[model samples]
Target: MSMRVLKSTGAAFVMQNMRTCVNKPIYKETFDVNSLKKICDMLVVSAQQRKLVRLAICPQVTQHQIWTGALMEILNQLEIEMCVKDCMKGSNMAQQIVVNCLRFLDDVVSYDPDSTSWMRVAPKKDADSSPSAKWSDLLEMFNDLINCLKNDHEFLFYVIKLEIMKEGLSQIKDVLVDKNIGYKEALHQQSLVHKKLTKSLGHSSRCLFTLLLYYLYGSIQDIELDICWYSEDVSGNKLYLCVGKIIASDEDKMLMHIFKQLDRALGVIKFVHEMAEMKEILEIQGHLWCIGSKNRSFAYRGHNFFIHGISLE
Candidate 1:
């Protein structure tokens, strides 16, 4: 069938079949690898046409059938050199294919069939025939691609760096350490691969570093804004000062407000200090308020006061 027609009909067919099997188990014995491969090939054609096609297949089918056969076919076509060559010339078809392949692989590996009752694990025939073994093989392929990207195709590597980190590093980690598979050795090996990948990428690009920090800390906050506060009692007898730092993930408008508050606070402090020196007073009587308008306020000794603060950017 022509790919144009296939793209339209293939997804409908798969969705229809999937809907019918909603409450039923999809056995590995009855899984159709050839059909899955044909669908994957059509996805490639869709990418070549610069069209977006969403193909929804059973995750069980993807995990079991595609990993063993169809996935290799997709991966083989994801050539880094092709992507780089096309990208340099202002074409994105090759890069699109790579993206589609990554999306397919993501769908295959990201699904957690162990938590569902509709997908049963196929019986293992030997040590090398289990699902964990398949995952190990998949990890090996990812490591090979990553190494190639790091060593030779630096440009293409940065282009798809986030997707690789999300799928290869994040999702694959979940698969390797799945309680059902329990592949500790495989997980350890994957960790080593990640360490090498990160070390190599960390030197040249901040993309991987940002992603790694997000994965490690659950958020990326690289911009540290130091803040200081100065306050005095109503009697102006005692001075209180607090200093700290804020780690911001992005420079949003809220940060601008913080900056303004810091500037205002610094001005107030300077004015108060100069006046205190001019009068030869031991301390200033009025508050050196440097707090943002929206910030928290506290009441002390029947007087409400704002915290004096400034950012050391």
Candidate 2:
């Protein structure tokens, strides 16, 4: 079929199928990966032609010709299976599939939040040219792309990591470990409680950092080359504070394990502290670890103090 004919017919078919699915439960399941791929493929082609698929897909709409939420769920599942599990990482068409799926997601999610779902049925216009014209939903789409693309290349991972940090930090800064949580007890308490509290509040940065930490900490055997890429924003501060806390608290095994995984990236932490002008704070924290190393002497205000020293001064 000519691309134009396919785009028109495919969009019409999707609308009709979506309408039928509203009344029939079986039709809901019918919009599986293959069905979604067909729709997404047509949307991708249409996008190339500067014609986006604009159908009402939100909850309040009466016609209910599309279910964007369900569509996103399917995409999430396929993403996990294909990208996360690396099942289709080697497939020739996997990248295209991912690109189309994400493009369609951006399309549906790009609907003006202020507009009613019914308004989505309007004819396509200049607003549909870019997949991310409406940036309110940008991260929701970018996150999936990041997860899908990160494992593919270090430079790509670095790029997406920076973007995520910018967006995630701006929108969900509270879920971030407080930069002041530099003390061991504070860090420990925060780690134990932040996950549950953040989940209850419907935030994501906590989970994102927790998972990233898990990956970094667990990579004791084969750390990636771009491990240093995480040394900025949410990841960098959280980790720096985390390491300082762990070291201060005498988490000997964990400290050693994390250090091993971090390898040479430890320098990045130093650089990060320098950039933040928190070098003095890092030096002070370093003393917590040095307490066990050896005796040290320092003179302060005409008084001499030594490591493990007891003095009235």
Candidate 3:
């Protein structure tokens, strides 16, 4: 099928499916702590849970159909699973982990908050001559890749993905251990970030950080790459971006860029702090881990950003 045709049909099919399953239960009626624990146990020891999540969040599926149900279901299961075995086993913490999982899907989906991004898909009207759009070809290539992965039982990506997940769960433990109010406050403020990404209430920065942590844990095959952070805070009503890495030929350039971004971020933090009255905010400082590399001085110059009241954690 042509790429445009596939796009059109795939979209239509997805819309139809969304309408159909919009009401279908994505999860079991009641949250079973045991079943959730089972999933988590399997997840900790096996990589299949990560694979299911990665496939479920694939752009092709998420863009077409609303998989909130599937997500909720899996999340509910995981929460149940983790609570029994781990000290973090409570309705509150369980829900937090599950909600964090949803944010992963948020990044992969075609999200137009204002519904004005349709032009990204529509072919340009100024086509003078028939230029065969590469989109169709790309889609075909992706489809072929998916088929090959399925046929050959390729599972390397999810292997990395699972490693990241373990990191996320570990963060939960870390959050519990940290006793500073600033750390707790930042964690509380992160709830807003969670809401922005998932549009779900009562969940925030902890989830975004969890996602960041998981991605950071997951490694790129054979490449010493940097981290990418997309985090937010709604209570503080601020957004944070750590898009990819700064490509620099020398430390001086990298330090300069990092300082520049931090200076701008500090400005943003100050503005947010002044604009609100006793508002909650998330303070995040992101620095790429360059361990096991040359000249890994473990310094990125500036490494802090604030939303409400900035504090080093």
Candidate 4:
């Protein structure tokens, strides 16, 4: 097919055809570096346009020496430096291309050749041998790409921020919250923060709150919830507060002040409601300490709890 035809056909169709072609020995023999480069160029453009393209090059493809050599050559010619420069200039398209390329290389290098189905054909003894030359080359190429990307300070900052946002999002579901309501609420908040971070480098108040939660109380299993009614404020408003304390670690001591600020910024009622939802969901027992005023009315997991002046010391 002509290059124009391939481009118009889109990544999904081309990727499927490439996968099928790889299975044929003649296709492998005839595939040259220029052809592979063209295919990759198409993929980069598609990905830049935010289209998903299942990677054609993977561990299974690398099993063939010819394909591996072609991949190495294409990787060598990758315009990673130019792409990163564009990324530093605030080009989201360039950023997407760079991230996709890095992730693609990461997938290739992290794959275990032994896990491939073709490995079953080889004897166990042969499969257990040291890493093959192709694997070594892929690893070297991945490292080179990383080194190149890291050379640009601004690009490296952007990459680190993206990774932090990813980690924060992944852990949001694991947060100890009510399955019915708190889960959705927490997810929405986290998603908003992620969206803001993606468009700009600035951190919003919600971003600070998110980073604090994930950084300090990320593991719900080891967290302790302390809820209490402090003295009435000057305006005669009763203060009900909930504080998250790390039960098993001393790391909280150093950042205790910062955590307090972040928690307080969310206000007492909202904070207590959030913590109560989590406490009920996780069925956390014995770690909860309630103090101060009796006859304080508060809401916990959609239930009204009227507690007399009782302290759980």
Candidate 5:
């Protein structure tokens, strides 16, 4: 462990006897965002205090590394620090709130957390560590997917935008609401931001979604999908929020197909959502459905979409 660690990372507060929720049934929670923000805030404050201390009793030039590490720790605090300015759920916030959320997402994504050291969740031991399974292969695949998440946001988003364009305006409204970016202006802002970012960066860029999917499961399967805002009542009441259909089958072929494309489609969905919520031109998140017939009945298939405790699309 590095001796030059920042005090009050806010980890203690986050772990202060909080209810231990693993994978949520509906949504996934990765790093504690609120805790992250508070840590960043303190790191910033500590820097100011340090500056005053430095002025009075400046350390030796050899001690520069210590101060540098301190600053670096603050810079690295972004792993958890997200802009808590926006509501995590609900469609009530105005365009400003949407923009605020987008900005937070943008900064969070754009800021390279790997640039400096950050807290990492411990890895789980594979059950197949015995002589039978290729344990090294599993580690390689896992590492590859992590890289994909780190680098593959833009390529994934492009397909999502295409899908959203096909989904129509009312559908677009549903998308906004799902991501907590609702109302006329916020949706428009996301579109506008995406346009600006994509314009300078070129329209066709590649991301790591497919590659990562291939790395992890050898393909994307066990995906959950839905169709939203396609139905309207006679008087035009918003009845169906989103229709979910998990593509599953007893036959390996059908299940495999869904699994293979799932990562790619989810990559697309995440791309769309990230781009939409980014303050600048970052991608938000988006998901797709492949349930054509829904004939297969597997006990495990229904809950496939929400694996990591985070929402899929």
Candidate 6:
């Protein structure tokens, strides 16, 4: 063959070969906001149905893993949406994503206490066998979503605060009033608290609701006490008085100002009693009562401590 003809023929062959072996650009999977919302909605429905089945008939099914996987996928997509800073910002889909994430976590916590440790919730067996699931990635995803909670997502914040307050009220309801003691009245009071807390999304209103939460759940670690701890140890009646007093005091008004002041006053009284107990402890060690001395220093110190702690609170 002629050199020119051979070169042209070779070039044509090479071009054909290149065309045959052309590499298509690999596209990464991307989901838009609507797609994400739809995914989360379907997953939520599936999880709910699974929970019902697990609760009703078959308790041994491997359901949490399925639920967790769905949650992980949703969160990963949401994180990407958050990073992209596009049309998803402050959208209803974003809010729904957060709310659904929290609801999933709450469901997990409620169903599988073992899953509370996010780092290890994914089955370890999958690590040695399957290459698909990584619990560590799930943990990272969870942490990312959790950190997002502190952002200026007003709806997200409101939902989280409302959930916390509702959980606190649920805890306190039993402690405050049970079947034997005005259960109907207790339900009514809880309904009122719920109504009040859900009324306004204002910061001050949120603060007031959160204050009620703190009174119910906040620890008096300085005094080494809390409502739950006290309720568990002492009679329910006294603790009931402390919690129910606010609802009882202003059943008609249900004013935040009145409840807040009452809550603080009760806290002070509680600390004062706690101080007296500490003074007794000192007395037991012969610090308060000496052989030939009548120094009321312990009482004075207890009173001062009570006053200082209340002021600090």
Q: Please list the C-alpha lDDT of all candidates, in the order they appear.
A: 0.35, 0.32, 0.31, 0.31, 0.27, 0.30
Question: Which runs in model 2 stand beyond 4 Å of their true positions?
Answer: 1-256, 261-266, 276-313
Model 4 whole-model lDDT (C-alpha atoms): 0.31
Q: Provide the lowest-lDDT 10-residue window in model 3.
A: 27-36
Candidate 6: regions farther than 4 A off: 1-89, 112-257, 268-276, 280-313
TM-score for candidate 2: 0.20
Q: What are the per-residue Cα lDDT tens digits for candidate 3 across 40-135?
A: 221121344433333332222222122222333334544454455454324354345345454444432334553333333333446584542211
Clashes of 3: 14
RMSD of each: 26.2, 27.2, 25.8, 28.7, 27.2, 31.2
What TM-scores do the predictions have? 0.25, 0.20, 0.18, 0.19, 0.19, 0.23
Better of 2 and 5 by TM-score: 2
Better of 1 and 2 by TM-score: 1
lDDT of 6 by residue, 1-313 (tens): 4534433443333334334221221111111111112212212224444333223211111122332333343345445545565454455544455555555454332433333333432334444663432223324333444454546563363334433333323322322212112335434443443343333222123223233223333421111111110111123223211111101122224334333433443443333234223212111000111122222322222222111001101
Candidate 3 TM-score versus the reference: 0.18
Q: Give the TM-score of candidate 6.
A: 0.23
Between candidates 3 and 6, name the one with more favorable TM-score: 6
**lDDT (C-alpha) at residue 267 in model 4:** 34
Candidate closer to the true structure by lDDT (higher is better), 1 or 4: 1
What lDDT tens digits, residue by residue, belong to model 2 across residues 94-160? 4555566557545433534533333233234376554322223444444555554556653353334
Clash count for each candidate, listed in order shown: 1, 0, 14, 2, 24, 0
Q: Judging by lDDT against the true structure, name the best candidate.
A: 1
TM-score, prediction 1:
0.25
* lDDT digits (tens) for residues 266-289 of candidate 1: 333333233223222222111212
